[model samples]
Target: MESKRSKYILIGLSVFCILLIGITSFKDGFLNPLRSGVGYVLSPIQSGVNRVGTSLYNGISNYSTLRSAMAEKQALQERIDALVEENSRLQSEQFELQRLRELYDLDQDYMQYQKIGARVIAKDSGDWFQVFRINKGSADGVQVDANVMAGGGLVGIVTDVGAHYATVRSIIDDVSRVSGMAQQSGDTCIVSGDLTLFGEGRLRLSNIAENGDLKDGDRIVTSNISSKFLPGILIGYAADITTDQSRLTKSGYLIPAAQFDSLQEVLVITTLKEEEAPQESTENTEGAQTGA
Candidate 1:
């Protein structure tokens, strides 16, 4: 009896499930209301899941775009920095070239003398290049009293020399005196360096002959009688000329041709004026002996 009861229960369950399926298949079935209630319960959950997925995707996309933009900005900035550095280097080279060209032209202007280039290496404690040193020395044939020229005119003389260095005393030094002559009229005068007067960019002009015709704006050059300086090297121009109180000589100021404050490269004439004296003395001595 137990076995038969179990079989009947199984058959009844199968029939009930088939009847439920048939009832729910119709358009106007009794289960329609139930289906509507189940859909209403799940609709909000599905909509919420779709909205969350869209927000997560957008957040990831925006992060990627920001990173790309930042990388591009950094690259552009680096390029700009490199270009700026290159431009600065180019400008510095251009200025150096111009200075070299000026030096070359000055060399051509006084081509009669043999010259060697020397850069200013050190200087005394002052605003002016009253005394300075050069990189060249006796090893380079730089001797004492060698004339140094720069900036289109006479600069100074080499006073002391070393194996690899040399000291220069510029024309602006207080003890400096150069015998200069007017290029226009050949009138001679004495140019004395005075640091006090150089504050106004001038040197003292004295010992000018009363009858001399050297006037304002006359070009002053190294006189042929100058013992140290070579002849015809430009010193400066005359200015503010006046007669002395004694009425024996005229005195005034001279504007220097070479700038004293910013001496850089200079040309040292390797030929010394003293070198010519020995040969001249020998020639005179030989002539005297022949006459005897």
Candidate 2:
């Protein structure tokens, strides 16, 4: 019975509070401090919750933007790499085209001789193109003792020829010996290859006439007496002419006209001198008989 009486007292208090709120809404109380106090307390809490929501949203948005920027940067870098590779390929092709054009001009200049252009396939492991191989041989009208020319002058002789390739022994080789003469004075001299002197881009010239009037910077060319090379092929310029110890002959250095440092393409004169052709045939026949 006492529990029942307590429950009734609580219900009565709740009704009284409701009636007071209704009276405040109708402005029945002076100043209405009840509504004013509730408003003042709840406003700051609602504002705090809204600010936290906005900050979380902005942070997620910024993270998405950063990821997008990284992806774009990676794509741009790949594109730049591809462009650089393409540029290198174009430059290589341009150089090859230029080299072919220069060879064409040389072919025209030596129109009197029958020439077949061939690319340098291999070179000696030394500092010079002393002994190099070309991409032409017996099948292409190339033969042993055939003269090779490049860069406007004699380079070497085709010393060995196979079915599809030939080996050249350049004038710069230590064993090379070419008979040449001073273009100005017709003074015959032997251009002998000396490995030591070749290091300075020079060849030994011997057997020159003491009174040949050969001087420094005189043009030297292949003599008609050369066994393998053709006549009148520009060898190089003569320099430092001096009387040899024998006093009867003069000697000097000959700077070769052809740049033996770089050999890319060459012209092989197809025709062997008429006198050498028979001897070459005779040698080949003799070698075949001996093998048999």
Candidate 3:
């Protein structure tokens, strides 16, 4: 019976607390000072929480905007790099085009011979460029012993020919030789290349007559005695001349007019000189018998 009385007392206390809160809410005049003070203290805490939430939201938005901006910047940088590369390529192409135009003008000035314009395709596959391949070949009328020129000067002679390509032995090659004459002095000499004498930028001009009047800076040109190369093509310029050990002939160095190392486009003379035919056999034999 005592336990049952304790339970009833606890239930009565809860009912009194509920009635007090209900009356405070319904009656406007029941303004308790303690409750009002507690609410005033908590209002500042609620406002502070709201401010913290708003600041965090703004910070997140700003961070997202910064990330997007960085991505855009990276994209723009890539585009700029691409544009720069393209601009460089176009400039190089323009320079090459200008160079080819100059070559074309030089070719037109030499219209006496049938010429075929060809690009240098490859250099010899060895340490030295003893031979170089041109884009023109038998199909283009290029043949062995054809004269090859670049930049208004003789560069080489075609040594081998294929259907679509031809190989030229440049003037710098050791095996190449040309009959040359000093334009100013009228001194005849043989222009020969030696690999060991390359770095000096010169070719050997030997067989100069002891009495020849060769001087410094005399221009050398292909002589009429040259069997393969056409006569009058510029070979090089004469340099210092010295007597041989026996003093039988004079030898000198020649500065090649054509920059063989930097050759790009060359013209190949395709037409060969027609040989003169002998007189008719019957008429010649009758004249020879009468003279005998």
Candidate 4:
């Protein structure tokens, strides 16, 4: 019975809605004022709802756009950082390659000498590499008095060695001295190091014969009679050559071929000066035997 009553109420409401629509269609209908009053009450409410919906839609769209822009910005920043790191790595590699090429050319310049490459591992106090240690030692055939070379010319001699490391005293050391000769004039001179004067990147050249032909810019090399240094190895260029006050000898400065301010890698010539003399003696003895 309750179901029947609800069915009847729904049918009656549907009929009433159709009749109300017909009545409202007539312009002179009795409900015209009532319809107008209802419209006036609900119009503002409907407009307000529509405005709120539009605002919500616009807000959602703007928020999505901002989020996308932020994501893109973050990605671009990461890309820029990666590119900067790559550029730095490439620059470091290029510099290392240039240094290696210089060492290779130096090796070719003294092709007659057998050498082992070694890296500088430590140093004494001061700005110059006046005294430093190398990674090679007696285990690698490095020995005391073995010549150490870098930067296109002679750098130092190995002074001490252990099983795994060796110490070098460069030509710029305070007590270092070399017997050098002018390559062009065949005149001998003394090349001495002074840590104080090497601040200007030059060594001392003195005791040259007064009548010697050595001049400014002449090439100087290790003399043949040098007890320790190998013969014909370039030391540096003569500069500021002047005659002594007594007219007995000439003294001047030498701009060293090697730069001692920074040392990273070097070549250790395993050949000892003492060993060379014995080889020459042996060759002489063989020649004498052949003549006999």
Candidate 5:
């Protein structure tokens, strides 16, 4: 009996809805109360659907705005990084220029000698001051036996040359030997590089005459008798002189004037020393002596 009653109520509601629509189409104001009641029943569902749509639209808009802002920030950060790198590069270039200028001034001071400038390209693979390569070589008129000098004094001599580079064996190398003299007392000595004396940055000066007044702080210069090096080039100062076991001659340490470890640029003298020629006897003199 309850089921039958529910079916009847549903059927009555359908009829009521159709009648309400017909009345509304006829423009009848008398059914306003019924329309008001039905509108009130549906209002809450419409409001809920509108709220959900607004919430979804707002979420999408916020996500788009955040993505755009992040992209802009990343682009700006990349640009800032590029600018910083460029600044560092420029600073390094400026420092290099200053160093080259100092080298140029040094070359100008030795204008009396025919000189060529070269940049240090490489250092010896094994030791610090054993050997180094210069950017200039045969193509730049650099040849074997060219004297190399640094800030303080004579550094070494060129031993090998290539098309674009030259190798110099510094005076500190074990293979190097130079004829040196005490500038003050004219004492002659042989300066040789020894591995044992490398820690003191000095070379062994031997063969000083026993009677020679060799003293500490005496300046040592390259002697004219040296075949490879030019005459009168400053080499170093004397230190720790003492008699050898044989007591036949004095020996000491020569502190090198040139700072081999800090060498960056150098000048290679191109002019060779003029050689003196032997005088020839006249043929008339020989004939006169024979006739006499």
Candidate 6:
């Protein structure tokens, strides 16, 4: 039955084509209007299909361009971030180099003493360096009572020593008392720590002579009479010296030479105050035996 239906359809299409030919032959112009009518009806439909195809092609092209642009922008941003980080690292290293150079000069000034460099690993609570830990210890010739310094002058004394680390008690600590002598007139004074007023970065200077020639900005150095500190180490300048009401002694504030808050690296002088005395005694004993 399907084959018979197909055969009838084919015959019908053949007859319709013959009819069209015959009509066209009849007047030579009968088929012209029909052709024109078909063309007029299909023009808008053809245009619509072309427009749809063009829109699809343009959309795909624009999407690809947008993706490429976005990828390029992401790559550039990552490169910029990497460069910024590298620049920051370089700047930090430059600053550290400058500080180490300053410390090198300070070390040269004390050529008589054996020294080692140590980085500060920890600090005590507060704005001041009341106590801090360094990377060097007894194994590095850093014994308890060893003198520590940085920047321009004396910083602290080693209070504890371990195999690989040491602890320092800065002169700005509450329990610190550094005997200071005036570099100008040899007048002696005491530099006592008082954190109650440490916010000013000044320690209490006292025990000055009533007629002391100490004036404002007189350089104070560690006194020879100091029990623990080596003499001649610069402390800081005297400021605001005022005699007590009794007039027997005077007291004032002293700004420390070391920047206590931002201490990063320090130098430890291995010589101890008590060690010098014993060595001197041994020398004296040998000299006496030789004399005998």
- What's each prediction's clash count? 0, 0, 0, 0, 0, 0
The predicted structure with the larger lDDT, 2 or 6, is 6
Q: 22-91, model 6: which lDDT tens digit per residue?
A: 8879866767898899999899889998999999899899999999999999999999999999999999
Deviation in Å, model 1, residue 179 alpha carbon:
1.5
Ranking by lDDT: 4, 1, 6, 2, 3, 5
Better of 3 and 4 by TM-score: 4
Worst 10 residues of 6 by lDDT: 283-292
Report how far off residue 259 is in candidate 1 (Å): 2.1
Q: Write the per-residue lDDT of candidate 2 for residues 149-252, one digit (tens) a residue.
A: 88777898888889999998888777778878888888788888777899998888888887778889998987766656667788899989999898898888
RMSD of each: 9.6, 9.6, 12.5, 10.7, 13.7, 11.3
Expressed as tens digits, the lDDT of each residue in 1-292 for candidate 4 is 9999999999999999999888778745767798899999999999999999999999999999999999999999999999999999999899878777888998898888889999999999989998899999999999888888888888988888899999999888877878889998899998888899989889999889999999999999987777677878889999999999989999999999988987898999999877876323322111111000
RMSD of 1: 9.6
Q: What is the C-alpha lDDT of each candidate?
A: 0.85, 0.80, 0.77, 0.86, 0.76, 0.84
lDDT of 1 by residue, 1-292 (tens): 9999999998999899888777667645766798888889888888898899888889888889989989999999999999999999999899778767878988999898889999999899989999899999999999988999989899888889899998988888887788889999999988887899999999988888888999999999988777777889999999989999999889899999998998888999999876754323222111111000
Give the candidate number with the greatest lDDT: 4
Residue pairs with backbone atoms closer than 3 Å in model 1 (clashes): none
- Could you arrange the candidates by TM-score from highest to lowest? 6, 4, 1, 2, 3, 5
Local error of candidate 4 at 133, Å? 1.7
lDDT of 5 by residue, 181-240 (tens): 888888888888765677777888888888898778998987766666666677899999
Of candidates 6 and 3, the better by TM-score: 6
**Model 4, TM vs. native:** 0.75
When summed lDDT is taken over every stretch of 10 residues in candidate 5, the lowest stretch is 283-292
TM-score to true structure, per model: 0.73, 0.72, 0.71, 0.75, 0.63, 0.80
